[model samples]
Target: MSIRKLAVLLVLGGMAAIPALAHGPHSLESMAMPGATKTTSSSRATVSPAQLKPGKPQAMLIFVRDGRGRPVERFALQHEKLMHLIVVSDDLTFFDHLHPQYVGGGRFRVTANLPASGSYTAFADYLPQGGSPQVSALHLQAGSGSTASVPLTPDSPLSKRAGDLTVTLKLDSGSIAPGRQTPLTFFIKDGNGNPVTDLQPYLGAMGHLVVIRQSPVLTAADYLHAHPEDQGGHSMGAMAEMHHTHGERQQMAGMDQMAASQKAEPGSVSFKTVFPGPGTYRLWAQFQRNGKIITADYTIAV
Candidate 1:
C-alpha cells in the first residue's frame, strides 16, 4: 500500500513503475541530493504563441534537462512510447493522451488543440537514460475571455452513462486511503443493465484508465495515469499491429488518441491503485465497443 506498491501496479511490476510514480511533492529531498538518479528543477514549460488559440493546433516543446540546465537526450520506452503526454483542462472537462516525437536535441514536439478557451495543463511523462522517470507539468493559457476559475470541489459521481454504456465504479474497499492500494471494480453495461461482452482490444490492452487530480497539484498526488496493460498481458488492435511487422507499437507520434478495449467477466474489470494524497479526483475510463471508442467520466473523493 505504499507508493512503491502503487507504482508497481502501474508500470508492470515495482521495478518499472516505482522509479516513475515516485515523483510527488512528498519526496523531493531524495531527488535533490547529489548523485541521485532523478533531477530537480523549478518546473516550467515554453509555449509557442505564448497563448493557445481555441480550435487551433498549438505547438508545445518541453525541454528535458539535467540539474545543469543542459538538454538531456535519450528516453527509455514506457507503455510502447518514449513519452506519454497527458493534457487536461482546468475544469477537467478536456482529457487527451498523446505520444510525442523526439524531434531534436532534448525537445519533444506535439501539436495540441483545445476546443474551448481556458487554462490547460500538459504533463510530460518520460524517463531519461541514466535518470529516473519524471512527470513534469507546464501551465498554458488559451484564447481571450473572462472565464471564471473552474471549481475544484470533490464530485462523487459514481455512475455515468455515455451512449449505450453505463459505467458504475464500485470501490470494494468501502473507504479509500492515501498510500494504500484501493481495489476499484468497473462495470460496463447497457441501458437495460445487462453486462456487455465482445469488448475489443484497445492500444494493446483490455482498457485504459486515467485519473487526474482536481485543482491541479495541491495534494501529494496529482494527475495520476496508467494503462491497464500494453503488451503480453492483453491484446492490441489489429490496425495498430499493422504498423509494425514485429507486432509492436504503431508509431504513435503526433496522435491524441484515447485508448480502450476488453473482454472478460464480459463487462467487469478490477484494478487496484494508490492515491498519493487525500483529495478529489476525476476518473476517465476508455474502452472500445462495436469498433467505436467509448469514454466514461466520473469523480471520487479519496
Candidate 2:
C-alpha cells in the first residue's frame, strides 16, 4: 500500500478501537505508589443508568471491598473531603472534580449534572480505613451525541493571559521523555509583565496541576491525579524536589517534614512527573493571585 493509504488505515484502526477499550486511567495502587502497600483491586464503583442524560442529574454508586468478598465501610478523609470523583469525557475535553457523601454500609452516592452527551470516565479516589488508597473507575455513556475532538490552538501557548496576570509553564526542558521524571513548574506575572511577589494561598495551597492524557496509551493508569501532597500517594515528593535549585537532596529531605498547609510562593510549585508513554497530553495549571484564581492550559508531547 502507498504511504498515504497506510496512514489512513492506522488512523481508522485507532478510531475503531476506542469503544472496545472504553475505560479511564489506571489506579494508583497498580502504578506502584511510594509508601503504599499492595493494593487489592477487588472493590468496584458503579454508575446508575450506565449513562448520563444531558438534562438530568446522574447518580454514582461506589462500594469498597478488600481482596476478599467483604464490603468495606470506613474510609479516611483526605484533603478535607471524603471522596473525590473525577469525571472526564473520553475526548479529554470536559473535566469535573466532585465530592460524594458516604451514605452508609460501604456505599457512597454522588449526584452530578453533566454538560453534554458523550463517552466519559468516572474515577473514585479515596483512602479506605486502615488500608491503601483506592482509585476505582466506571465507564459512562451520555446521550447519543458524538464527542468532540481535542481543540487545537494556532500555536502551542507557553503562557496564558488573564486580566493583569500571566501564567506560564516552566520546565527544565521543552522535550519530555517516557519513563523519566520531568520537573514541571508554573509562574505568574503582574500587569507590568514582571514575576509577581503577591502570590498567596489558593484553596489552602500554593498552586495545583491536573494532568490528563489526550490519547491514552496505558490502560491501567492513564492520568496523573495529584494536589501537591501524598493524599493520593507519594507522587508529590518527586514533584517537590524538582523545585530546589542546587541542594536537591537537602530540599527533598525538608519536604518529608513539611505539611500540606505550608505557604507556597509563586513559581515554587513544581512537580516531578513521569510520563508512562509517548503521546499528546494536556496540563491544567491553577493558582491564586491577588484574591483571584487563574487557570491556564498548556499542552505537551512525550
Candidate 3:
C-alpha cells in the first residue's frame, strides 16, 4: 500500500478525536516553554474528502501524536508559529509555506491547493512542548492520473528572477558538499540591475531557506529549514528580536522599512546549513520586499 493509504488506515484504526479549544492563537509568552527532552513525536495527515482532485482545494488535517499513540496537546513556538506546514509536489514544480490553524487537541487544519494531480509531500515542522524540533512527512495523493517523476537537474546559473527582482545565490566555498557547513548568500537586485537595499523583514527574520533532497519518496530526514546568520552577515536573530520587542502588528506597519539595514551589506541575505548527503537538493529562498513575499527556487548539487 502507498504511504497515503497507510496514513488513512492508521488514523482509522485507533487514533482518537480531540476536542476543540476555545482559546485563540497562542503567544510565545503564554506557552511557558520547557527544556527539550528526548521524547519523540509523530504526525499524520488526512484529506477531508478522502480523495483530492485536480484544480480543487481540500482541507488537510494534521495530527501530532506522542510515542504512546496519544495526541500531543502542548506545543512550543518556532519562528513565531506553532506549526509550519510545507507542501510541495514530488516533481519540485510546486511549493507552499503554510501555518495550520490549531483548533484543539493535536489536530491542525489547513487547505491544500494542488494545481495538478500528482503525488505531493507535506512536511510538518513543529516543536512539542517537552520535545526537540521534529519534522514529520505525510504523503498525500490526489486522483491518480500520471505519476511520472521529474528528473532532478542542477541549475546552470545560480541567479534567477523572482517577479521584478533578481536573486543571485552564492556559496562561500563556491560549491556545496556533504557534512560541511555551507554559507548560502543571496544577492538581490532590481530589474534595472541596481542593488536592493531595503529588503523587509519576513517571518521574524530577514529571510527563510528550505532545502529538500530529491528522491523517489521523501522522509523527514530529507528536509532541512534554515534561517539567516547573525554576525558578519545578515542576522535573523537580531531581526526576530526587534519584531518581538515591537510586536508583529506594529513592526509590520512599514513595508518599506528595513530592520537591520546598516549592519549587513546592501542587497544581500545569507543562510548556512550542512547537506545530509550528496544529492540534488531543491532550495526555496523566501524574502519580503515592499510587503510582498518572493520565493526564488534553485536546484543545487552536492
Q: What is the C-alpha lDDT of each candidate?
A: 0.56, 0.53, 0.65
Query: Highest lDDT among the candidates is held by which one?
Result: 3
> Please, what are the lDDT tens digits per residue for candidate 1 over residues 1-302?
11111110111111221122235774432322111122123332233333567898765655555444455667666546677777777677788878878776676767788778876666667766544556655555677652343655554557888797898888754659988867666789998999887666565445667787775332123766544422233322233333333324444411212223233355775455677777677888877788888888777787
lDDT tens digits, residues 209-297, model 2? 66766642222256675445432334553443343222234333334414432344434455557887777776777666677777676
Candidate 2 Cα lDDT to native: 0.53
Steric collisions counted per model: 1, 5, 0
Worst 10 residues of 3 by lDDT: 31-40
Model 3 scores a TM of 0.77
Residues 21-98 of candidate 3 have per-residue lDDT tens digits of 223554211221110011113233333333467678766566665544456777666677778888888777789999
TM agreement with the true structure for every prediction = 0.68, 0.67, 0.77
Where in model 1 is the C-alpha error above 4 Å?
1-45, 145-157, 216-220, 229-264
Q: Positional deviation of 231 in candidate 2, in angstroms?
A: 18
- Candidate 1 whole-model C-alpha lDDT, 0 to 1: 0.56
lDDT over C-alpha atoms for residue 238 of model 3: 45
User: What lDDT score is found at residue 262 in candidate 2?
Assistant: 33
Distance (Å) between predicted and true CA of 171, model 3? 2.4
